[model samples]
Target chain A: SQKIEQNSEALNIQEGKTATLTCNYTNYSPAYLQWYRQDPGRGPVFLLLIRENEKEKRKERLKVTFDTTLKQSLFHITASQPADSATYLCAIHNTGRRALTFGSGTRLQVQP
Target chain B: GAGVSQSPSNKVTEKGKDVELRCDPISGHTALYWYRQSLGQGLEFLIYFQGNSAPDKSGLPSDRFSAERTGGSVSTLTIQRTQQEDSAVYLCASSLAGQDRTSWYEQFFGPGTRLTVL
Candidate 1:
């Protein structure tokens, strides 16, 4: 069965440091991969979308890279702040099935 | 000044009772989706509504669950004879269809309705 997996269940880092989260999938080749930030008890908010054709994408303080060959995506938050603490999820959009399949997500905690 | 919205932010029901959850998508959004999040688990796709077409109900867990979108704006998900296992946060999301290819239904989600079948 196709499955998406985030590297860790929880990560803790200093506020000024960088946080990198990894997402790997198996038995599936997705056309596009998206990242979302979800706080406890709230809906997920869209963060970034990287296509299979694009190697990398950036928005403000965040960066995402997609490697179709490796079947993985890496999400990075630079100069992370306490506000960046949340569960980050990576979603895949299979070619014919556009509805996203989300990973379990990695929880990040940035301490000041 | 608007995003996707869902009603009854929290629901508490007894076993064998029926419950209805409603969702109001952003104006003009052609696509709507329902997802269930169990404790510490990833979001599970439940159902999807795209315009007037028949919904993709493949993700629905069982025959006891059904959903409908009326006039392309509002949607309702009904769970019959709710069980304790039915407890979870029910999330609703909407997005514009036929938008940029890269976005590929970049959904805007609503603050989910937390259903507790006690």
Candidate 2:
């Protein structure tokens, strides 16, 4: 069976520090990977996407790296602030199917 | 532009009862999807619809779960004989089109309907 895993432990970081989240998968190869930010009591909001051929993708203060060979993806938030705190989810599209399989997600807390 | 929208922000129902959740996709979006997020869990794919084509219902958990899209726009997800395990926040998202790689069809999500089956 295919599996996707993210850090189950909550990460606490000081404001202005970089926060990195990890996502690992097994038994499947995805054409593209995506990251999303989800707040409590709300749906996830799409953040960034990186293709298998691309090593890294960036948007403003967010950056994502995809290493298909390692079956892992890293999402980084640079100069993080309190408002940047949220649960981050990593997802991959299932081939031939329009659905996406998401990892458990990592919760980041930026304390001022 | 308006984003995806869902109705009944919250719903509480008894076990064995039926419930219907609605989703209105963004105008012009050709692809719509339904997902369920259990408490503290990741999103679970439920179904997918594209234009006027037959929808892909492989992700539905059981025969009790069914969904339909009308005129390629609005969608309804119906759960018959709802069970306590069905309690979750149902999310809806839409993208411009499916199978288009050139333009990453970013999915826009709705606030979701939080269903509590007791």
Candidate 3:
């Protein structure tokens, strides 16, 4: 069975600091990995995506690193703010499929 | 231009009743997807549509659930004889295209319809 796991425990970090979230998968090799931000009562918003061959991708204050060797992806939010407090999800695209299989997600709380 | 849009932001229906949820993908987007999100759970893939190709229904939980995308634009997911377990938020997303050669298909999601099967 294929599975993707993220840190279930909520992560708390001070504003202006970097917040890091982890996503690990097993039993599959995805063509690409994506990160999304979801707020309460709203659908997810795309953040960044990195291909299997790519080591890193960046967009504004967000950066994502994909390590196929480690079977993990790390999402980073630099200079975090209270507004950045939300659940972040990691999703993977399976072979021959464009749909994403998402992990349970990690909740990050950026305190001012 | 408007992004993806779903109808009936919230719906509360009795168990065993049939429910239909609608989705309008972003204009010009050729790929659409449906997903279910239970409380405190990850998004569950439900279905996918790309252009005029046959839909990928592999993620549908059961035969009671079915979906159709008309004219490669608007889509509707129908649940017959819904059960209590059907209570969840149904999300719709659209991308330009599905092939890897196209731009990375970054999905733009709708606000979602919250279906409460009571």
Interface RMSD score of each model: 0.7, 1.1, 0.6
- Candidate 1 ranges beyond 4 A from true positions: none
**Model 3 lDDT per residue over B9-106, tens place:** 99999999999999999988988999999999889999998874645889999999999888989999999999999999999998985466535458
- What are the candidates' individual DockQ scores? 0.84, 0.79, 0.88
Q: Please, what are the lDDT tens digits per residue for candidate 1 over residues B1-118?
A: 6999999999999999999999999998888999999999889999888885545778899999999999999999999999999999999999887657554469999999999999
Against the native chain B, each candidate's TM-score is: 0.95, 0.92, 0.93
Task: For candidate 2, give the docking quality class from DockQ.
Answer: medium
Report the candidate with higher lDDT, 1 versus 2.
1
lDDT tens string, model 3, A1-112?
Answer: 8999999899999999999999999997889899999999999998888889999999999999999999999999999999999999999997788888999999999999
Per-prediction TM-score:
0.97, 0.96, 0.97
Clashing pairs in 3: none
Ranking by TM-score: 1, 3, 2
- Candidate 3, CAPRI quality class derived from DockQ: high
Tell me the lDDT of model 3 at B65.
Answer: 95
Instruction: List the candidates ranked by DockQ, beginning with the highest.
Output: 3, 1, 2
Model 1 Cα displacement at A87 (Å)?
Answer: 0.5
Stretches off by above 4 angstroms in model 2 are: B98-105
